[model samples]
Target: MKRLMFSVLPLMVGLALGQAVPASIPLTATATLMMPDGEAAGTATFTQAGNGVQVTVQVSGLAAGNHGMHVHEYGRCTPGVDAATNTIVPFGGAGGHFDPGMTGNHDSPQTDNMHGHGGDLPMLVVGADGTGRATFTTDKISLTGENGILKRSLVVHAMPDDYMSDPSGKSGARERCGVIERDSFETRNYPLPGPQDFPEGVAYDAVKDVLYTGSAANGTIYQIDAKTGNVIKFSDGGAQGRNSALGMKVDASGRLWVAGGASGSISILNGDGTPFKTLMTPRTPLPFINDLVLLPDGSAIVTDSSRPTLFQVTPELRVRKWLDLRDTPIEYQPGTNLNGIVALPDGSALLTIQSNTGILWHIDVASQQVTRVMDGLNNGDGLVLTGQTLYVVRNKDGVVSKVMLAADFKSGTLQINEPLRGLRFPATAVLVGDDLVVTQAQLDKRQKGAPETPFQLTRVKRF
Candidate 1:
């Protein structure tokens, strides 16, 4: 071995045994340095070692120079850098290097030479060609457990690592960064063990103790046996019916409400798969009907991003109230798209506002008042109320935070349950008493015009 010194230690090891692994974690990442600007992008691959990890990173497209690199306190890397200071700050609020021991001090190879802080790593050097590669290992990091490594972030510094510097690298600031999160074994192109196939849309039927999923590509609804994970196609709703059958909700009355996106219609089905009623949106008009939620008073709230309005619908499939985001005071800007809907126990509902603003709005059904609940969230997609705590899922950031519901829903506190890591574009969520039913929607951008595949449905039971 040449013993090349690089930063962002790679802890994942490549296995030649060929045995299938359930979860593969990202142990290493590489980055290139853009000269004056100090911008970069690269890929990191994580592998498993004995009871440890190994990582390999190859990054290119940089300004060409030595860039400081260190594992950050959070894994999410977005918006690039801090504009004012132009430094690398962790998304989860840079909590002193990843030192589980409460070390409180940054150690370099020379200065303290203690090898204490998880944020300490070798520097990455991007050559004149704007490329860099580094491979290293760290036994102090992991994906699971209270002392796991990735609960922090990996940041790229603007200057070269001095190796003997204290605290920060003296490398100016962090130009690029990415938060390390747990990798789900249920991804398609990513690969995992067991049966890696899924039908399509997921619906929870407590009475049946099974999950019903519809496949738009296959034009069939598969009833998945919960305990066994075996799937059997239950119904054929035709090509159009299957293609548009994206959102599904089971009301208290046991009626299954399906939103036919491509078909521009809503179909109400009996528990036995009988179609009781069908309501379609206009043809010549616009907007795709994305989500629907049946209220307690026999009313439904529907969302159409194309029209970009939340409409209150009657049981007879009539539009009763059209809630335009522009009219609402909850900061629904132009680019922000609305997604999931959940009706609270007190008749209020929370709507997902997918925007950089990261806002979750509370809507009072009786008064039609929209209150800004929380902010600083990216892709505020799924909202679910479990007991007195409300969990909001952020899509782009891959985080699920719990919000407390005090006397009035307005001035409550919020805290993140750091354990539930590795979530990308989390869409729908349901409360099975205290446990959460979360659906992971991973968009595969590898193939052009290809719909994302290999979605995951997870049941997160937190104590």
Candidate 2:
């Protein structure tokens, strides 16, 4: 009997001979439900499964009864004044039910055709303990495509759905709401022109929609079309006294500022790769100018890995040793002392990372005072600051750590370390849209022998 049932199952589901099965792509989203008083309720999750979507919901702190749950048009869960009642309503900003097909009818999840709302689902039943759990699959909704539910809201109504009513199944007020957000994970690689170029720094030109990368093996600057991924040599090797380009940035004047590693120089070039200016730093201490950050006032601050100092370029293009950490709380080690630098949003202070000791330092731009902020980031090579968040790229670890900095720049908490699979000695990164294009310098492989041919950059999304 079991064998007979198995044989007839394929026919029951309308399976055809030699039919190709669709591949299931990994896509997921989650939402945290909150009550009107900002109280925690429960959570809901959505996952792509075959040709359908799997939904799991767990709710608590509600009356023991049936409730209507659905996806709304907007992701907002804030309270707003209701037009009909002229009173403030909870989660009213979520708007109406999600109806991509503009269907005016409220029906069941098993409803055929596009006559019913896509967000309609089965009724949720709460137990005596005021807790409810549901797990189901529906073909009417999806995580992508025209009926994608990303950035939408999941609402739980006060009353159960009748499964056959106009508009919203006559469901009562929305008691709990949560915005569904996608879990982003995407990676791409763009090949460079040289076989052993060993690119170090990356910078993006938002206005021109192009990307620029520098070669550490030589001084060649490569320009890449952002949309097409086409590469072109912007400048030849050793151009404008740039023996090695370690860090780079494009200022507001559309000029590219290149950090000359070991050459103790800062080379400025026009957008067309013409020579603008080259400022040489103190050659004594064997200056290894590694990375730099442009300030809001058109000035720039660069980190020196070999020396215990940071070089600043004034708005008048004058170079000076802005802050020296020799007498400060930040202890500088022997190898690669400071690698990456970033200025805070308010321009009051700056942040730099030490590669050898893994200490993060905060410096006051006005007083030039330096203080230790955090540690345990050994091998931290590049730094990117967005608001109060800091992204630290650890070269040897092959991972980028996301850190949440305190408002006063006194402390920071490490969030998560996102690993790049094929990353080889990543030096620095620049934001392009919602992605991070990391320069894979491959310095470790270069030291061993002939590094990998045709060096490339890795583009990571949602890292």
Candidate 3:
């Protein structure tokens, strides 16, 4: 492949730049970077840090080397065909580095000075394996009040940026580009009734047309009208266990069972969100009861991350250990043992191991034996089953996988028929009508400032 360097190649490209301050103050802005063919390579999330801002970039599908990445002036990522190489020129219309100050200096972020162009940023370093992560703090940008990068574009060059270059550093072609949207946690298509208490689990009542969500920090249960977006407090943590609610499910009888993440308890609520039964953890002192799936007899099979154990809540609310990771042959991390579960009709359940396994396994809840069902999924958080199909949600990286499970539950095939739509670190989901309502957990473990964002449930069409 030929290079598109300013010194070696002819200069035939021109880019337009613009700047605008958002009318409302936003806490965050995100950019979804894409390749020249308009394929999403990864995401760049900019959040409000201390005085400046923190940009965390997770990218893939690039050549191995240090690629120059910067914020451009335009919000457009228009692609055009190049006459010289007969290849697609990515983000051709996204203007050069933002340069609101017009200092016209290519100052690399590592050695940046105040006099450098505001658009100048640190080089985006990619690895040989096609994935990269670059986290940096910039005092030049803000996601808060005036003159922020609300309407800008992020550009990833084809080559490295030589810090002292006059125009755009000696970076090569614009391989990847994305538009930075000025959206915050507060802004959403759905209306939230009260302050978001950082919810992680969600359950939809198809018969009643109401959606149930719970707070992971306080165990406050919220009920929202699926059609009108009307929200109200259902069950306060006082009546139920006051632990952090993590996973939730409404059984066939309309009873809701909620998993207490850190408190190691399971609380059962009536269809009206009335407290029914509360079962505390067994044996272990520190437990992370993460997710749960209901059996045919209303027994809940819960995944405990820190304990490497599965607790079963019987129909009469008797909680006991149903499975143990140490008893199985599958190798996995202790604390990150399992998350997200789905029960089959034949008394078998599918579970997700978050860390080492990174795959789905079918387990006999009665025997405590597990068999591998599928692999290649990382950080799978939640799964919803409808007939023979399962939709698994990966919380750390927002994406859903549609898997078709066989009738015997012994085999399943994973297919990516279409790319998943709209997800902000989804934690759990429930199918409501034709749309699936997903709860944004906004897990604060990895990202610096995420849990502060308003927790929301996004409804997306299920394929």
Candidate 4:
């Protein structure tokens, strides 16, 4: 048995270097300001102009007076303990002003002195209505080079800058801050062969450099060349005794394992699309096998969405009922119950989601004990787990949620719900290198008899 080692450090490094602004191309960046208590302060935008840059800032919910603003060295805006007083300080993680030139002085924005810090900017004057706006251009800073502001922090101070103070402008305290991010990445789409393919699941074969997508409308499987973006039919659903294919994965031995949706079956095929075997479950309540994950020992754990049950298929192809959650806190609703599943790297436990109830549950493989981790993730259809970061694809919400789980997997924090462009109703995603290729499963449109032509799989980089 081989262990799954997941790490995102290399991917993070690639993204950081990829965001460096090219000298010939125009650049744009933005930041959403947040207050100490997690309130929306405003936004800031930066655009490349000539040899310098143009900056615009708009803010609200502040006292009617001047506020000092600057670009900080770090992109973090979380509260931190103050070293001087041992008290919590808001937005203290942003560190000090951005000073790439090693300058220790703070001067006017119009200053040409080398001692002036590059982060020194004009004051923001708030009106009686608690709103403020500032727009200016300066050659002291740029979108590229040593003084570039990408991946930095924008901060607003409690008091105004006197334009001559050293180190800091005597600007009482840091009131609000936002992390600056580039707006350069775009989603790339690859066309599927069928006009109404309605692909629900996607799996990448790193060994062959190919991608496989299963159709929800029909059980037809399509193979796509990852390098050339060419699509071809791999197997006919009807001929293969499959009604629908919802979730699928490729094991290390080059065998494809597919979860038969509403068919109560699991299909195993060779790398050449040759049928290996098919295992069927009881169809008392009309089982909906939504998704699955391959364990370190070559066995597979599958999720039955219509019931609060999980099925396991051993490496030798023996099938049996694995874990039943009927007596646990997880309830089986009228619609989808347990949809997506992922095993821990250590193969000690598994994390599964309840779509109807929006709850995440952790199950111990050896003990068969279930613990409800968290809720409020309604419509979470498929899940992609890398290290402690989990991505939940919400089909109805048309968004993908990024969550950071604790080391023990008993708790997690919802980071952000990002909406992907051209995502009709994303079903599931597979990580290919640093990109996430998501299936655009327009199930709603398919039921309405008006799905968009030539369904697509969108690739999102650094998601």
Please list the C-alpha lDDT of all candidates, in the order they appear. Answer: 0.54, 0.78, 0.68, 0.78
Task: State the TM-score for model 4.
Answer: 0.62
TM-score of each: 0.56, 0.60, 0.61, 0.62
- Candidate 2, residue 38: lDDT: 85
Return whichever of 2 and 3 wins on lDDT.
Answer: 2
RMSD of each: 14.4, 20.8, 14.8, 17.8
The digit string of per-residue lDDT tens for model 4 on 1-463 reads 1111222111011122134333344456788999988888899997756546678899998898999998876667888653324567898777667665556667777764266777888888899999988887766665544456766789898899887776668876888799877666466678987876899999999989889999998899998988889988887886467879889999998888889988888998888888988888766677888889999987899999886788888888887888777877788878888998888998999998899989999998889888888888888988988999888888866667778899999889886555543256788888888878888897866754346556888887644
Model 4: lDDT of residue 161: 89
Model 2: per-residue lDDT, tens digit, 243-285? 7988899999889999999998899999999899999887787
Q: On residues 213-295, what C-alpha lDDT tens digit does candidate 1 reach at each position?
A: 55433335556556565656555556335454556777787777776655667777777776767776656356556667777
Instruction: Give the alpha carbon lDDT tens digit for every residue of 37-153 in model 3.
Output: 888998998765544567889889888888888887566788644322456666756655655444566676643334566677777888889887788767666543222465468
Candidate 1 vs candidate 4: the TM-score winner is 4
Better of 3 and 4 by TM-score: 4
Q: Which stretches of candidate 1 lie over 4 Å from their true place?
A: 1-201, 214-220, 237-242, 282-285, 330-336, 348-356, 417-421, 444-455
Q: Candidate 2: misplaced stretches above 4 Å?
A: 1-185
lDDT of 4: 0.78
